[model samples]
Target: MSMFEKPSQAEQELKWAKIWFKQFSHFHKRGGKANWDFSPDDVILFLRSKRDQRMPAWKRMKILKGLLVYRRFEQELPIDPFSFIVEKMKEIVANERAKQDGYDTIEDVVGVIDPTEPDAIQQFRRALRKDGMRLQTERSYVGKVKAFMADRGLRCLADFASVRASDVEAHLTDLAVDGNVAASTQNTAFHGLLKFFTLVLKRDMGPIEAIRASKGKQVPTVMSTREVASVFEGLEGVHLTIAQLLYGCGMRISEAIRLRVKDIDFDNHLIEIHGAKGGKSRLVPLPDELVEPLQRFVESRRALHEHDIANGTASVWLPYALHRKYPSAHREFRWQYLFASHRLSRDPRTGERHRHHIHYETFPRHLKVAVDSAGIDKHVTSHTFRHCFATHLLWSGTDIRTVQELLGHSDVKTTMIYTHVMNRPGVRIVSPLDRLSEATGRQPAGKSYQEGRIAYAAG
Candidate 1:
């Protein structure tokens, strides 16, 4: 069958009818269709007229789906995955029955300290997350806490810090041995557990890095300029524009996806990024190339906003009661999305269907398609654009400090990473090999600093 082929109504019915007939048929026998001639039209009508089912009925439907396949195989017809799905449904029903009978166990179901307690770990976890603690951090901390508690089999809050350094070491060793979790992964877990013991539980956990991690050997993946161009060119339509905003502005994918129309300042050519990373705001220079697209997007989005509002679907993000403060902001064109989703989305915090930014997964799907078309052999992801942005800027001789501001890095030390991308001797413009040669006084090894001084003077 062609990959994209849409099966005809008759062909579809025969396929499903055989399935239902098989479920009711005995496995050893000809499966009940032995007496009657098979017809596609009858099967189609049967499947179409099948009633909506509760879970138990759904299980029976799965059994029917399986039987159709078994008969098809006996007759040497084409094998479809739909038959496999029927068999899986049988397994699911069996598993569900066992669960109800308590023949099997589920993780995290009961017997942990009550999370509703004022200072319980789960309560803190919820509070920190609501207060905007990073998701990865929360996951890591929860994992570490669970591992530590489960090993000693301690469940009470009173057990905190009663476990010694050896217990922590044993846990880390077990993770390395049994779980095979990476050294870096273990370090993150350690840091999270350390934070809890030191900060929240008020314990004297001296030297948080006592169980230190080995140096990780991961290098950042970045696309070369030509590869980046090809990737963008292969992408059709406005997706390229969104990718450009991601790479060109050096913004995180989350920040770019969450952006609103009013965030753009055309007058000053600045893009305001609000509530980034730390519940703080920062602004970056908007490229001149993006202006026309932004304007076009704005006009189309305004028309959509009117339609959505009329349909009672335009629930805008005028956060913290700003909707009350500025009564008409929700209906305003400047407050709508520049690249809104094809479908309306509900806010996680508020259960309201408002037109929001495009979903994160959609862009990644587009990116994968673009990557295939571009013929990029390297594994590339959405965040690779951010890495490319930093590397490209560094390669172009932009100062580290400037790239740091654009990337929103709090530390200049973090910006030092791009020096590897440049392969140039860092800020001092001195290399380790040159230093070694100079130390030996071998052939006046290092290149002269005269041109740098002269170029510096010219600037």
Candidate 2:
């Protein structure tokens, strides 16, 4: 085509497709197959590769659309399989364009917290967000700080500025003595107040000499193997899979639900847990029995992702401003949550509609029902499974350091708690009463006087 002449529609589409295919070929070399010998998965991989390179969303979409046009008109290949990609890319392009036009993007929206919230609380929240605190942590901190302000009649920023260390100390003491809050609760409140004064108010808080809440050394609740099996019998489908992950992989409920499709490696028999407690990542061994079930689960998740794509809502929330970095990754299959919620929900932070993982609370509710059905008397929560995981591993002779790493504990001291609860077969200690009975070749007497006399006479 001459410089002044306009290219035909067919020529333009072919050019677009060729440009995309060229880039795709660089990533995936065509040895003996034709240039067009690629599947939807290949197309997805190519798009993801572009995303990783931080390519502009519009450019990526243009190339992909060109490929579709060329394949349909020139190659006469079926375009049905690529429909999901087309729809998802169109949505991405529209969002990018909207952002370019100075429209309010998802990032511009405020969180679900009330707009009429106190200015001090809002400032505290902003500081927490700037520090990359988790949403739950932010809420807790804000609540505690707000309570402190309310209790002290500090209605505004100026009031917060006047807060002294003694005031904080007295308030915490009151929480322990008057409110009767638990040790952890008081400590959480203390930390929240400390952060608010130090970070938000920019004031130095002197040493806190408040009367501390009494803390007790409480062991975690762990289910026996039989009770675990009984609970499993009550749970089915996604809940069962999640419970298994909690116990089998030593994963916290938050870690299990937040899992992405790419995190699971079936061939390696490993699961990658990212952004776990303390913002750490670790690999856990995938149970042999879970391999097939997880495969089937992922396949179903893919189908659900396709449906979301067709509906123009195929996107997930990426942490740490990753969406800004990899614009197309949010819509990729690998980023879709492993255990996605059935319905689309509005993001609290961005106010955008996206499919999040199943709510963390849902598992515990199911677990409570399962525990009750299993006739378990222990107070069982979703976290009990994690405790069971650590204790059972120790019981089965797994090294403590290995268990610590799998549980993602930074210090071995945390993992040592399980050793107290774990039962050792070889080191098992017989009760004194049982030992006495064994030595004398007779059963121990009952506690009642009449039963004790009869048992003594019989012996």
TM-score of each predicted structure versus truth: 0.56, 0.72
Tens digits of per-residue lDDT, candidate 2, 1-459, equal 221124575577687777666666667877423335578998898888888989888888887887676677657888889878876885676566546544456333224555688888877876665445789998898889888888999887877666788898899999999999998899899889878876577655777878878888888988888889999999999999999999899999999999999999998999999999999999999999899889999999999999988999899988766676688989999999999999989876667788999997888888889989999999998888999999988998899999999999999999999988635655777788888888998855654667878889999
Q: lDDT winner among the candidates?
A: 2
Show the lowest summed lDDT stretch of 10 residues, model 2. Answer: 1-10
Shift of residue 210 alpha carbon in model 2, Å = 0.5
The Cα RMSD of model 2 versus the native structure comes to 19.9
- Name the TM-score of candidate 2: 0.72
lDDT by residue for model 1 (116-199), tens? 533446654643343335555666676777767778777767666477655766777677677777767777666666666644
In order of listing, the candidates' clash counts read: 3, 0
Whole-model lDDT values for every prediction = 0.66, 0.82
Estimate the TM-score for candidate 1: 0.56
